[model samples]
Target: MIRFVPADVGTIGQKRKQVSRACNGCRAKKKRCRHVEASPKDLDSQIQAAQLAKGDDRIDAINDDYATSPTADSSTIPASTRPSLQVSPSENTRNPVCQSTMAAPPQDTLAPRFVDGLNPEGVFLAVHSPQDTRGAFSHDRVGIWLADKLNSKEKQNDRTLTRSWPQSSLLAGRHSLLPPHESIRNLTSIYFKRFHPILPIINESAFRSLGPTDPAYILLQQGICLVASMIPSSKGHLFLGDSEVPLQHREFGKRVVSAMRISTEAGVITDKIVLIQALVLMWMFSDGPDARDVSSLLCARVVQHIQSLGFHVYRKSPDQASHYESTMLCCVWAIDRLNATFHGRPVLMHERDFGIDLAVYIDSQMPCTRLFLHVISWLDKVIDMYRPNAELRSSDLEIPFDSFEDLLVQSQSLRIPTPLLGQFIILISLPRAVFSLSRIWLIFSPKATIETLYHAVSILSCRPRSFNTKILSSASRSRRELSAERVTSLVLDKQVCQLTYFPFVPYAVSLSLSVAYSEMRHTKVPMLRARARDKLQINCGLLERLGEIFYLAGLMSDMGKSTLDEYDRIYLTAVEDYQQNYSGSCAALDSIRATERVEIIDNSNAVPSTSREFESNNGVNGHSLLTQESDPSFYVDLPDLDVFGLFDPNFNLDGIDAYLEGNLNLTYPTNF
Candidate 1:
């Protein structure tokens, strides 16, 4: 097998040029024959030339080649220095991008794009001092730079504002976002059963007493109905047909927004507790995979409310709300940790900031809630252990008790609720999925060869020692396959069902789907590929199921399928290269196996394709997942690109790279 190393930008014999070699005048006396730098047309030719060259392992550096594409703006402002958060007031006022961004939204494609939270539209990357190189000093800067780089590849992908949820739906004459009065009772019941246990913010008795008439309870009731509508079976549909469900959802959403505004912005705080609960419940509505989401806003207000109420520093008191406050504080901290991890922001509500004794309350809670706390507690430690931007290395995943297996044991002993358990399967499997993505990163990084990635992806099918000496020798323990097996088993054990309804579930499902894509696309062994294909179908079903209610999941599903289709088209080209290489006649293209396309098998429930011929060809006993042959014909083939996606573990980098190019048929110039 040839080691396949794709240069970021290259043509067969041509090196990618930031500046053309012939810088001098070629039309004039032809003195030096210097190469002139590429125009947009030249860059396109250079990439096409690299594709036709059909050679691999041309360059070792991380992919750096990009030019102003037809989609990208022709000009950029050069960076004189990096901006700091603590800049003086005068300097901040002088920055027009900040003022313009907030005061008026740009309607054109040339509007600035935000990197991290700040706009990097007009800035060029500045050279760092000797001590401040890439991936040094601050992991955050490295992440921001990577984001800027990928965003440059997708400058024109921003959707027009009109494509979002209709403003008329929310702002139209006095239409409340809530369901009908009778429907409210049903939705409230659904919310308590489906969302309340996990969230534990709202008090059941207060809602019963206030009965949606009071301003405080009104907002709280609206929030409950808004989130509950995500349940396809929640019966908040207002007797409108299924086509009207989204409209019904928007109405509920409208009611929640109106109720919150009137209570908080328009009048005095009526009841602090009710207000906080409503804010917390509304947090799920801030992000949508497919729509324009206010992802960075709601969490901050929720944090402020918690701190303002002194929930962060409360001691058990004679007050009737003391117990509720304690539980709510713990929930806030846990959710804060999740938001920090999910959004790549700093943790706003840290454990150190809390004055409450959380463990006592956690221990006294229901088993399911207790299990949720325990899971989140371990996650906090993991987040602390690694910078959200640092790539996982071979040695990094040897998680010290707290190994994922321990969490599994704890969950089983506690009898975690089935829905939360489904969420847990998604949650605990996260580190491994992220670790697996990190494995893919090794393929591009200077650390390892592409073959190592193949071995890592096939961990679920391989024996413990099969690749340990080559791949895991650096780590103290071999945990790669064990983690993979656990993920497979957890998903296989349960029927596909709705995970706890929240913004995070669809996003997590998206991440898991990306891992399946890595395995499906990169595995060299046929049986492993087949197994991966099966997993892809299951995850796709899961994502689509969630997509029905969550706009983000639906957006992700469409994006994943489109990207896979693009990769499959490219794969056929590589397959031709692979066939030629093995023929011993075409060495230039042999290493690029187009036949190794992104496989999207039809269903997960189909019987495994195990046959005596397959076992013999792969030289494995019937039990081993193998097909000794590398021939494309040996296994079933997919005629179309069914689905493919990437959820990078570097959560900070997740929103960029994979998703920036989403919704468009954009392709990285390097890979064929």
Candidate 2:
């Protein structure tokens, strides 16, 4: 999760000095207090100032350290129920200055301000008192590193880029990114006509009225063209004059983004509402073609900029507010939450940030807008449970499933389209299926593993229908083979991995593929391995198909292929081990069973030791991660390494959190 440190913490400590009597500032206002008593009050004021600088919420913790003493004295107040400063041995060890005489403030009373409003626990900083450590815990391994790096670089680059490139030159360069007038105008019309009906974040009539000279129109046009580049025609050309535009989909997106950044930095475009509308559209470009770092940096700026302009706090005034603003805010909230999970970091927008309730939209809201909000609200619940960035987590299988039933009931009541509803049901069922798989390979209880193995297999074999096949029924031969609308119509009519606008589908599918690959490597359980392999293949195929639509999924699909090859190597090692376990008992019998056919057989004697042996032997680093303390150690063993630590239901069940997880493929394209 995200964290913050008080800028005045060092100064607060430096200014503190031993005093027998109240100082001038305290003496003038308050007659009866020592200088030490004033320290706690000083801490509050200083921390508030620090939080203000960082643009975080101000804390309102009660100050109960004033009338306090180290020893029982005759001057002590009457024994009352009021809480006061007290110290324990643990607090004393951390603070030597307060160990001897100064009473430490109790922890339960002090409130640490949070950067990510949703997560209750994470690597955080506390500035309540001197007794409190500057940070809640060490963030050496669990902290958000990318956001920090990007945040620093963003400050430097935005300022540098603005000075290095003049507004006139930047504006001149932006035109080069745009497609020919006719080509772009047609593409924009197609996008609104085909895609806008499904995700109505922008109003069609009001938007088209604005001309090309308007900055809003220009930004929206650029964003739509970037989205359109991924969609190719049947002949594989974007426009009739495709030779004139040599830029590929990903490269085209990069140039457009750079131009948009320059225009914003130049302070030339001052229309806040339309600018945010374009920013929301840019996020739809996804993470691969357009870098995720760009999305994260933009999300931070837009959320802050929107709040600073009072968009979040006041939307009740009809003259100042409109349905478009409300719809856009939901889109922003969804993007923030989606990226927060994908990156496993803090969210910029919070549930309480906006006054509008996205789950229940106005009656006049478009069907697509309403459906999108409903889908997002359901997704938001799933994300909250995962809390991907939270430093501490309970075991997956142990968490109660009862809560999700209510979400299911709520979904059943919504007026979602039938095909879309079926896809959503499949999406929600994944967590349950994943939990069952985690119980099988990761758990040591043979009886439970054997039982869950069958249950998980049945679930995995039921492949999801991700695309809406019903749309294809309307496509006619003449419409596709003869009409000029063939290009746009095919993109809409042809089956896709899922709805083009819904972005989180790729991450869910990719993560499932990773876990399924992990589960399929056991080899000891024939049925289990076979079942997991099927799911892995299905997920990999979906991700591959999605690659054509979104480069993020393409990146994931590439990762999946590398993992598949790696798993084959691990399978070979497992077969060799099984051969070692069983010798030729019969003269005619084969020493080792065929690796491909082994999982298909259910004979108990044919299996060897658990996949644990495979993981320990063939680990990427090929080393034991355990310490003398038997503390949960995190180390990657390539394909078999279980760094996520969620593989085992019993392991890390208590307060433990693995320091790190995942085998990331950081080799990205040069366009980023």
TM-score of each: 0.50, 0.48
Worst 10 residues of 2 by lDDT: 659-668
Off by over 4 Å in 1: 1-175, 235-264, 267-270, 287-293, 317-321, 388-397, 401-498, 521-527, 570-672
RMSD in angstroms, all models? 25.8, 24.0
Can you write out model 2's per-residue Cα lDDT over 292-399, one digit (the tens) per residue?
677777777768667766656664643356767665666667667656655555677776766755454433455544444444554454444434332143332122
lDDT score, candidate 1, position 327 = 71
TM-score of 2: 0.48
- The worst-scoring run of ten residues by lDDT in candidate 1 lies at 441-450
| Candidate 2 Cα RMSD after full superposition onto the native fold (Å) | 24.0
- lDDT tens digits by residue: candidate 1, 631-654: 445344433322224232433333
